[model samples]
Structure formats: structure tokens, C-alpha cells
Target: MRGLIAAAVGALIAGNIAAAAADNSFAVRDVRVFDGDKTIPLATVVVEDGRIAVVRRDAPIPAGLMVIDGHGKTLLPGLIDSHVHVFPGAEADALRFGVTTELDMFDISRDFKTWKAQRTSLGRTGQADTWAAGLGVTVKGGAPLEMLPPGMSVPTLDSAADAQKFVDARVAEGSDYIKLFIETLSEYHDRRTMPTLSRAEVCAVVAAAHADHRLAIVHTQAEWAAREAIECGADAIAHMIPDRVVGTHFIALAKRHHIFFETTDDVWAGASGMDFAQKLARDPRVAPYLSPMQRATLLATEKKVTPRFFPTVLANTRALHAAGVPLLAGTDSPNPATAHGVALHEELQILVRAGFTPQEALHAATALPDAIFHLGRRGRVAKGYRADLLLVDGDPTTNIAATLSINRIWMNGYPVDRTLPKK
Candidate 1:
């Protein structure tokens, strides 16, 4: 099934190669614009030479340019997924659902250059842009060891010197950022045990990354681990603390340090229910955009409800968000019932359910991630930004689920072909 989807995506890419190479320009007039930060009730946005040219009220339509009448539609900056695991066709699946950028937390292969190039390559069609942390730093026989590919090397760090060396190697490999693993298996499983990096080691890695001018993000599912990561000067927390509700002290500390958080609520929710996946696959608005592999994976199995930690996760996220700590929307994609691209929409809904206003949810998925990651020239509908945008039938700023009603998606001024071939 994966092969079939890959082949179909390849054929679509080949068919669009000529269109992708040509210079693209257009204007979306009379649209309700969500300019990353707020909603502009009525506006016109123009794109030319693959960049936003003008964004204003009642702009004059230029002669000889293609125009899309966006009456009653809302225009938003393309969604950005802050946490994902990239694989073949992942970007294609993401683009189909209006996710134009995906920030990968870890990839066992450590092939950063290839993925980075694919992201920045202009005039490419049918793929979402990507930024990656090549390989995550973990301890010997750590949490991720069980998940690593059969023969992949599992490097361990103990001393501060070892931490520095590990970070240096990742920097040399062109990692966009550094990812540190600090998970304790006991937090998630009853009997399993795993080693974690010491606080000194984590601090050392953070210092090394900062010396190289890179942000270090940490993965932790427990409160103690999260507190340790923050004390160690990690810039972001990749997953929310799931074991219990975080207190005001930790929230204050995170705010003081300006640490961003990715509340991967979809991951935790999916862990207990194949229902989440099935619901997404069955949604009329999202089903049309999913690829064969995605559809098959979502419908493949039904698992009994297990103990869920997401209620506490949501509470912690609300606390951090209310305290002015930055939040990022991310779905730990391709994990269990979570699918790439589509999972992000579910995440936005989850955020709204967790006490975020719909606009706040949109901000978490758009402007916030771009600002936090320093991803330039994207994630906003403004003059001089990259022309990555999504047009939906209703106002998503008020009703978050409207995000899935994608009317059109533009990447670098080119309209993406959203049609899927019949089986």
C-alpha cells in the first residue's frame, strides 16, 4: 500500500514538473485573511515570482495576472507541524492537507542534507518543506533503543565531554537544531526500564548547541524530566508532560526562559484509541485528501482502550498557555493512529478543546512555530513572505474544524493539485 501511494505521488510530481518550473503568480481577492497573528475581515493578497507582493484592503487588481475570487473564504498561512518523523511520501501527504512545513524531531538515518535540500528547493511541486534535527542525543540503552532500526548505532553520553562531542558531530552534519532525549520508561510503561541522560550531560549538550548558534529541544514525558530539561537551558519541550498537571512554578520557569512547547496531544490520545484515526479517515473534509497508505493505516487495526494520560497533558498545556509560554501545534505523526499532515488538523481541534480560543489554536500551528524556530519568509500572509497559503470555505479562526475544509492550497505561488486518482 505504501508502494502504491509512493508511485502515485511520483507520477503526480512528474506530471506537474513543467508547471512547477514555470514562474507562478496570482491574487486572492476579497478574502478574510488570518495573517498569522489576527484576522483581517476583508483583504486582498497578491503573489508574484513565488513571494507575497501585496497585502492590503481593496487592492487594485493588476492586469494579466490570474485571480481567485475568494468570496466567503478565509485565507490562512499554511499550517506548520512542529513535531513529526519524516519518511518517504510524508511531505506529499502533508502538502495534500495544507501543511506546508514540517519540523522533524528525529530521524535515525541522520541524512540531514538530503531532506534539507528537498525543503529549500524552489520550483518543486507536491511536497511540504522540512527542517530536521538529524539525530537525537540519547543515553546508552535508553528509551529510543527499542525503537531504533535493527542495525543502527545507539550512541550514549555520560560525561560532559561526550555530550559536547556528540553535539559537534550533529552540527557538522548540518542539523537544523539539536534534539535531546530525557525519557524514563517507567513514566509510560509498568515494568520496562530505560536509562536517561544525566542532567550534567543534558546541560553540556545545550551549551554546545548554543555555542554553535543552534536551539536545543528536549523530549520528556514526565514532570521531573521536563523540569530538568528547562534547568539545563533547553529551548523547547517537544512533548507535553503527560503524567500529571504541571504546577505554576514550572510554568513560571518556562515563561522566564522563553521555552516553547509542542503539545503533542494527538499522540497521547491516539495511544489509547484507534478511534481517532478512524474518525479522521472518515471525516468528509479530510478523507478526500488522504493517500492510500494513510487511509489503510488508519483503518488497519482496532485496539482496546488503554490508560490515557492526555487529560493531564491537556491540563498542563492549558496552564503553560495561560501563563504566556509559547505553544506549538504538533502531532507525533506516523506514530500508531496518527498520520502525517492530517494529524495536525486534529491537533488544532485538540488545542481548542484544551481551553485555547480558535484563533489561539491557529496561532499555535502557524505564527508561533515560525517565530520560535526562526523559519524565515514563511508562516504569514504579509508582503515579502513566501507564498505558502491555505484557503478554506469558512472562517477557521472561529471554528477550528473549518481548517479541514481546504478549498485551495498554494506553495510558493503554485496551486497544489489536490485531486486523488480513483482506486
Candidate 2:
């Protein structure tokens, strides 16, 4: 009986090992794995189906599994561009740049639904995973309504009662979270009217969003407006205002409220150089992202408008970093000066320039954003995590530029064509 039992136990252990090995079918050999946290030199990452199975250094090779020789390469979690507008133009190239997951912070409900369906289909065809908040909630004659192109929905709330109805309509339309734009005093002056939403009304919208278990991300540019939005229980601030110096009080409040800051410092920097049309358009680096047609439109829109308030912006970004607010990577893409996907990498560079270590800046673009979105399956290289990863030629931890030096992107375990090369 003892001999029989011993044989059975040995067989059971063998079965378990086989199952574990079976789980790790997608393996990359001799690659340096930077698991979005620390470096594992000369490691192998085995991903089965669409999930990570194991990250082992010098582990035994499983039989009959596909392996890619990652010689002189580094493997890291695929980047997440937390804020982007993907309606048109270079948005598809985000995958080529190593942006595997993108969060669309604004777009109309109907359009968002269509985009989401298309993204789902593309996923079946092996594309990047895309998610969004359907159309930002704003006042009837608000900023987005004034700036965005035609066909974009801008639901405006006039009073506190109107705010509640607007919130309900957005939730019904499948908005992931509520986006608000609180007007600054200067903006109110330029528009030549009193701001529509009162403090109480804005607060009501925040309350309504919370009741529905959705977060509220506010587009506020001034210190006072930011404070008001925070007081109303906003979950995040979408931009770092360069117009005003943010004090420690605001930082303390932000920390207390657990508010995440999307420091779109790069967009501001790029937009600042728009006044020098010849310099901006003729420059080789900026030309690819900007078109002749778009430059003509920009020259017409704000022809005489020189770049505004740059020093303050740098200071605001610096202060935010010092304050320890959970910084998020975002580029207001498809905007006048910034393009999609490519611009996100520029944001990472700017963050690194503003005193962030390469690791921290990369985290903002990868692991941190996933954590912010409560996306459990995406980011990191652990068992059960999504196989969204980038294979690069050099170690990105040593230099920021190495982050964009992509060899290939594995989206849900399928290779993405970097050059959009012909079949």
C-alpha cells in the first residue's frame, strides 16, 4: 500500500509541473526583463495565450514552445498613454511607438460607442486595447464646444438642476467617467459673459458622478478653479496650469483628496513655439507631426497670438513633482500643436527633464496609469497580466530615449508591424 501511495504522489507532482509548464507557452529567451519596476538581467518571460505565465532567469526550457531570441534587447511592459484623442491622423501609429494601451479621455457618446466596437473588432484582428470617456461634460457655450471640430457633442448645463440631468444622460450613454471644465476668471472675461455653472452646481455634478460610482476629471486652469473642483470631490486634474504658481496648500489638498494630476507639460511646451511659424513648420522634427494644411489653419486661428506664459508652466510642473501628487502621462493629442502617440513619448521626455527619474517617468506612462484606471489585467509582467509588452534594443532605464527605441510590440501576444510594412 505504501509503495502504491508513493507512486501516486509522484505522478500527481509530475502532473502539476506539466500543467505549470503548459501555462507558459509564449517564451522570449535571453532578454533583460524590466517588469515595469526592477530589472531581471538575462531573463525569459513566458506568456501563454494573452496572459503572462512566468518571468524566470535561466529557467529550464519547456518543450515545443515558440521562443524569440531577444539578443541585446530589453523587455518592459507596454506603455499606456492615459490621455489621447484618437479620432483621426497618426492615432493608429500609437502601437508602433510602443503605446499598447490608451485611455481616450474625451469624445461623443455615439462616436465613442462606434470607436469602442471598432477597437473590439481590431482586438480580434490583433490591435491595441483602447478605452475612453464618452464626450466631456461642459457648459452650453463652453471651451470644448468652442474649440473642437463639428459633430462633437458638447452637453451644456445652465443651472444646478440642469447639471443633474446632464450627468444622468451621460451615464446612460455609457460614459466611463465625467469630465468637467471650470472656467477661469480670465476666460470669463475673454468670453464676455458670466460663467454658467455656479460652485453649487459644479459640486452637484461631482456628487451625481460619485452616486453613479464614476470619477470626475476636471479641466481647470486657475488656482481658484482647481481648488473649487477639488472641494467638489474631483478625482483628477487634467492639466498643470502654468499661469499661476501652485502653492503647498493646493498640493496638500490634492494629496488629501487623492487626486491624480495629468501634467500635460509637453503640449504646453509645443504650443508655446507656435508663434514662430517658419521655425515651427520648417523644423524637420516638428514637421512630420504638423501638416501644411493644419499650419495654415493655426496661422488663421490665432495669427497674432505669441506663445503665452511659459516660465510659469515650468514652475507649476516642478511644484507638482515636488508635491508628490500621483502624476499621470497625457498628451492632449490631435490638438493644434500636439499629435497622437508620438507626442506622448515627448511628454515622458519633458517629465524626465523636470526632475523625474527615467524609471518614474516610464512608470507614469505604463504601470501607474493602469493602476489609476483600476485595470487589473493590463500593465506589469506577472502571471495573469496582459501580454502587452515592448522589446527594445537598449536598456531604457539608463536613458530616456531608449523608451521610444522599439524593436516590436506584443499586443495580446501578437506582434505589431512597426513600420506598417507591406504583407
Candidate 1 Cα errors over 4 Å, as ranges: 1-23, 189-191, 296-305, 421-423
Question: Candidate 1's C-alpha lDDT?
Answer: 0.85
- The numbered model that scores best in lDDT is 1
Over the full model, what C-alpha lDDT does candidate 2 score relative to the true structure?
0.70
For residues 335-393, write the lDDT of model 2, one tens digit per residue: 65555555666778778777888788888888888787875567787777878888888
State in Å the error of residue 248, model 2: 1.5
| Per-residue lDDT of model 1, residues 284-390, tens digit only | 98887788877765565435445457678778878888888888999888777778889899899989988999999998988888888888778899998888899
Query: Candidate 2: misplaced stretches above 4 Å?
Result: 1-25, 88-91, 109-126, 150-154, 184-196, 274-308, 421-423
